[model samples]
Target: MMTRAYIFLNGVGEKEEFYKKLDFKNSSVYCADGGYRQCLKAGAIPKEVWGDFDSVSDSEFKDLEDSDIILRKFSKEKDSTDGELLIEYVSSKNYDEIYVLCGLGGRLDHELTNINLLFKYKNINIKTEKELLFSVDRKYTFINKKNKIISFVPFSDEVRNMNLKGFKYPLNDYLLKRGDSRCMSNIVCSDEATVDFNTGRLLCILND
Candidate 1:
C-alpha cells in the first residue's frame, strides 16, 4: 500500500473506535496544534505538530514541550486554519494519500469549511465515525459496494455529465448540482461500481 499522511484535526476524541481502526503502517502522523493532545490520548506518536497554542490547554502544550517531536508554532492571528497549514505541508512531502481524522463534527461553519478543504488535494480522504468522505475530481471506483448505499454530493455549483455504473439507480451522464438529491442514497448493485464525471469536482461519502 502507498504511504499516507494522517492528519489529526481537532475533535479527536469524538470517536474512539474510528481512530483505533485507522491504518498507521507506512503513514506519518501530523497533528494540528490541540489535536496533539488527542493523539496522545489515542496513544499515537505524531511525527510533527503545528498550530497556534490557543485552543490547546497550557498543560497540553507543556506535555508536548516535554516531548522531542518537531513543533512549529504560529500566532493565533493567522491567515489559514491549522489543519490547512498542515495539509499544505503534508502535500509537499509527496505522500501517496492524505487521510484526515477528526476533521468532521465540529462547529457548523468549521465542519463545512473542512469539507471544502478536500478540494485542496486530489488524493485526500476524510474519515469520521459517521462517514468516510472523499472528493472525486474525475472518476472513482469502489468494489465491495454490492449492498451498500453511498451518497454522491456535488461539491461545486454543478458537476456536469455525472455517470454511475453497476448501481441500482443508474445515472448516465446526469447533471448533479448542490441542491439535487437524485444522486443521494443510490444503491450499488454490483460488486464493482464506478462514479465518473466529465468536468468539475464532487464529494462521495459512505455512511458508517
Candidate 2:
C-alpha cells in the first residue's frame, strides 16, 4: 500500500528545481500535455499524458509516442481542463498519495482551478511544494509547514467546529463564514499546525 501517484504540469517557464524534489523511480508519473517536455527534461517518463495537444509540440508528441508513453488526448472542445482530466483519471486508480509538481507558478486561472480540485478528491493525500493538503470527509487539514503561514477560507457554506492548534491565533469551536477574517494571516507557532473544519469546503493555503 505504498503511495504511488504524481502529476506534472508543463506550463510556460516551469522551474527545474521542483522536478529534482520528486522521486520518479517509484511513483507513477502523469503529465498534462506539454508537461511531457518537462518530464523528459527531468529525466523522468510519464505513465500517461492527458490533455489536448494544444500546448504540446509536434516533435515532443512524436518523441513521447516513440518512448511508449500513453497519450490520452482530449478534444480542444472539452469541458474539464487538462489538469482536471488528469485528476479524474487518477481518482479511478487506487493511489494513496498524489504529488503535483510544476502545478504552481503557472497561469493564474489554472492555479486557482487546480486548487479547487483538491476539494473534489478525498482519501488521496495531495501535496505540492512542502505542504500536504487532504480532507477527511468534510474536514481538511494542511500540514508539513516547518515555518510557514496557513490560511483558511470557506469555499462552500460557513465552516463550523473550526479548531486550530500550534498556531499564533489558536481557535476553539469557532465558526468561520465567507467574510470572516479571523483565520487570515495565521502563523505556525510550532513545527507544524492543524486546521480542522467540521462541515464545509475550505481552501487551506500553506506558505513557506
Candidate 3:
C-alpha cells in the first residue's frame, strides 16, 4: 500500500465544498493556519494545524485550545512561508506521495510558489478542482488519460532531449526552452501517454 499525505491551504469558502468529496480515510491530513477551519467545515479533522496563526481568527484559535489536534506554531517573522514549512515537514515523513489541496486559485504568488515546490519535492503534487500539477524529470506515463487535455512547461532554463509519445502534438528529441508555449494545450491520443526527457525538469499540468 502506498502511503499518502494531504495538506490543505487557506482558500475561499467556495472551495470548502470541494473538500467534502475528498477521501482522506487512510491518508494523513494536515492544515496550514486558516485551512483548519475549511478542513473542519468539510467534516474532516487534521492531525496537526501548522502555521504562525496570523491568518486564523481568535475565535477559531479558542476552538482548538482543547482539541486533540497538534499545533505546530512558528514565528510570523520566519523566512519561509507556512506552506513551505508545512511541505518540508510532510516531505520528511517519507510518504509515497503528498497531495496539496486548494493550493491553486488563491494568491498568484502562492500559486506559483506551490508549483515551484514541485521541483524541490519529487513526490509532491498540487491538486485543484480543475487541474493536477506535477513535475517530471525522466519518464512519466499517463494512464487512462486518453483524450484529456495536458500541457508541459519547462521548469528549468531548458528541457533537453524531450520526447512525447501518444499525444496530439508529438515531440521527438526536442529541446523545450523556458517561456515556450509550443507544447501547451495538447490532447492525449492513447490510453497511456508518455513524457520523457534526458535532463531538466518539466512541469506537467493535467487540465480538467
Candidate 4:
C-alpha cells in the first residue's frame, strides 16, 4: 500500500533537501498550517491545509484560498498541538503510513513533542533533514549495513531481557536501561540484525 507525506512548516533547517526527495505524485500531501509555505518553496502542491491559522500569513491564506486544496482550521487554544491535530486528520482518513517532514530541530519543546507523539503509530516516522526515526514497542529486525551506526534508546526507564544479534556488540538477555551508555552507538557486523525486548519501549534511530 502507499502512504502520504505530511509536511510541517516549523522552519526546520535544510528544507530544500527535504523537497528534493519528496514524491509529490505518488503520495497525498498535507500541510500543517504554515507548512503550506514550505510546500510552495519546495515546489510541491498541497492536498490539504490544517492548523489554527495563527502561523499562516494573510497573504499565504489568500493564496491558498485561490487554490483547490482543502483548508481545515482549528482553535489556537485547542487541546492537541498542531502536529497532533495533523495526525488526527490523517488518521481519520485511514492513511496507515505517513512520512513526516520538518518536524524536528526548531523549538526544542515542539521538536521533542512531535517525536514523542508519533511513537504510538506503526509505520509512521518523522523524517528530519538529518535522519529518519521511529519508535519501537516490540521486536524489530533490521538489515545490517557494515559500519552503519544504529542507535537505540530505552523509551522508558528500563528495557529488560533485551537481545541483539548480528551486531558488533550483540546482546543476549541483557538489560538496557536509561542512563546506560553501552547501547548508545552500535554497528552492524553481518547481513542482518535483530532486536527483541521483553518490556519497555525503544526509540530507534538510524543515520540518514
Candidate 5:
C-alpha cells in the first residue's frame, strides 16, 4: 500500500464542488496558509498547516488558536511559496505519494510552479476534478484506463527513444521533441497502456 499525503493550496474555487467530495480520512493532510479554509470546507482537518499567513486573514488564524493541529509559521519575506514549503515538509517525511489538491487553476505563475515541482519530485502529482498530472521519467503505465485522453508532454528538450504502447497512435522508439504535437490528445486503447523512454522526462497528463 502506498502512503499518501494530501496537500491543499489556496486556489480551489474553480473545482470547489469536486474537491469537496474528496475523502482525506486515509491519507495525511496538510494545508498551506489560506488553503486551510478549503480543507475545512471539504470537512477535513489538516495534520499540519505551514505558511507565512499572508493569504490567511487574522480572524481565520485566530479561530485555530485552540486547535491541536501543528502550525508552522514563517516570515512574509520568505524564500519559498507557501505551497513549496508544505510540499517540502511532507516530502521529507517519506510519503510514498503526494497529491496536491486545489494547486491548479490559480495564478499562472503559481500554477506553472506547481507543475514544475513534478519534475523535481517524481512522487508528486497535481490532481484536479477532470485531470491528473504527473511526471514520467523512464517509463509509466496506465492501468485499467481504456479510452482515456492521455497526453505525453516533453519536459526536456527531447524525449528520446520513446515507445508508446496500447495507444490510439503508437510510436516505436521515436524522438519526441519540444513543441511537438504528436503526443497530444492520444487515447488509451488498452486496459494497460504504457509510455517508455530511454532518456529525459515527460509530463504524463490524463483527462477523465
Candidate 6:
C-alpha cells in the first residue's frame, strides 16, 4: 500500500531535511491549516488541506483554493484538533504507513495529543518530528528516537520475553514493570536494534 505523509503546521521550523526524508512521489500529502504554507515552502503541494481558518490567513486560504488543492474546513467549535482531523482522513483512506511532519516543536499540549493519537491509530506506521511511533498489531511498537537511546516501558500487566539487543543493559526473556526505568538509557551496540515481547503492550523507544 502507498504511504501517506501528513504535515501539520503548528509553528514552522526546519523543512529541507523533512522534505528529503519523505518519498513525496509515492506518498499522498495532507496539509493541516497553516501547514499548507509549510508544504508550499518545501516545494510540495498537498493533495488535501484540512483545518479551521483560525490558523491560516484569508489570503492563504484563497491561494490554496486557487491552486486547486482539496480543502476540508472544520469549525473551531469541533472537539477534534486539526491534526486529529487529518489523521482521520488518512485512516479512512486505509493507508498503512503515515509520516507526520510539523506536528512536533509546537505547543506542548498539541505535541502530547499527537503522541496520544499514536495509540488511537495503532495499525499505521506513524512518524513524528522527534520519533517514529508505530504498533505491531496491538502488542508491540518499534520506536526510533533522536539520540541513540532506547527505552522500553510496559503499558500492560507484564511484558515477557523482553529480549533487547544492541543495548548497554541487554536482556534475555526479562520481565518489565508498568512503572520502571530499568529499560531506560540503553544504547544500541549494532546498526539495527531488536526488541521482542511475549505478551502485553510495550512501548519500545529507540534513539537514532
Q: What TM-score fits each model? A: 0.93, 0.83, 0.94, 0.91, 0.94, 0.78
Give the Å shift of residue 55 in candidate 3: 0.4
**Model 1 regions lying over 4 Å from their true place:** none
Encode model 6's per-residue lDDT on 1-208: one tens digit a residue.
5556655556545547766776776778888877787777767768989999788888888888897788898889999998888887787777666766676666888876776676676444445445555543333323442237666667667777778765667788888877877888777666655677777777654444
**Residue lDDT tens for model 3, 1-208:** 9898998888653355566677788889999998887677767779999999998999889888778889999999999889889998998999998988767766888878878998987589888777889999699999999989999999889999999999999999999999999889999999989999999989999996
Per the 3 Å backbone cut-off, how many clashing residue pairs does candidate 6 have?
3
Q: In model 2, where do residues sit more than 4 Å from their true spots?
A: 12-14, 123-137, 140-147, 190-193
Model 5 error, position 50 (Å): 0.5
Kindly list the per-residue Cα lDDT of model 5 for residues 1-208, writing each as its tens digit. 8788899998754345785566678889999998898888777889999899888888889877778999999999978899998888788889888889888876889899988988876488888888989998798888999999998899889989999999999999899998888999999999999999999879989996
Task: Write down the lDDT that model 5 would get.
Answer: 0.87
Model 6, runs deviating above 4 Å: 9-12, 123-130, 135-148, 153-161, 173-175, 198-201
Q: What lDDT does the true structure give each of the candidates?
A: 0.82, 0.74, 0.87, 0.77, 0.87, 0.69
- List ranges where model 3 is wrong by over 4 Å: 12-17
Model 3 RMSD in Å is 1.5
Q: Per model, state how many residue pairs clash.
A: 0, 0, 0, 0, 0, 3
- lDDT digits (tens) for residues 1-208 of candidate 1: 6778888888646556666777765579999977787777766789999999787898878878898888899988989999889888887788888878778766777678779888886567887777789888698888886878799888788899988998999989888888888888888899999999888778889876
Model 2 scores a C-alpha lDDT of 0.74
Clashing pairs in 2: none
- What lDDT tens digits, residue by residue, belong to model 2 across residues 1-208? 5967878776543346756777888889898887777678877878999989898888877887787778888899989998888988787787877766666656889876776777787544445555554444555444565557777777766888888888889999888888888887788877666777677777765654
Which parts of model 5 have CA positions greater than 4 angstroms off? 14-17
Clashing pairs in 3: none
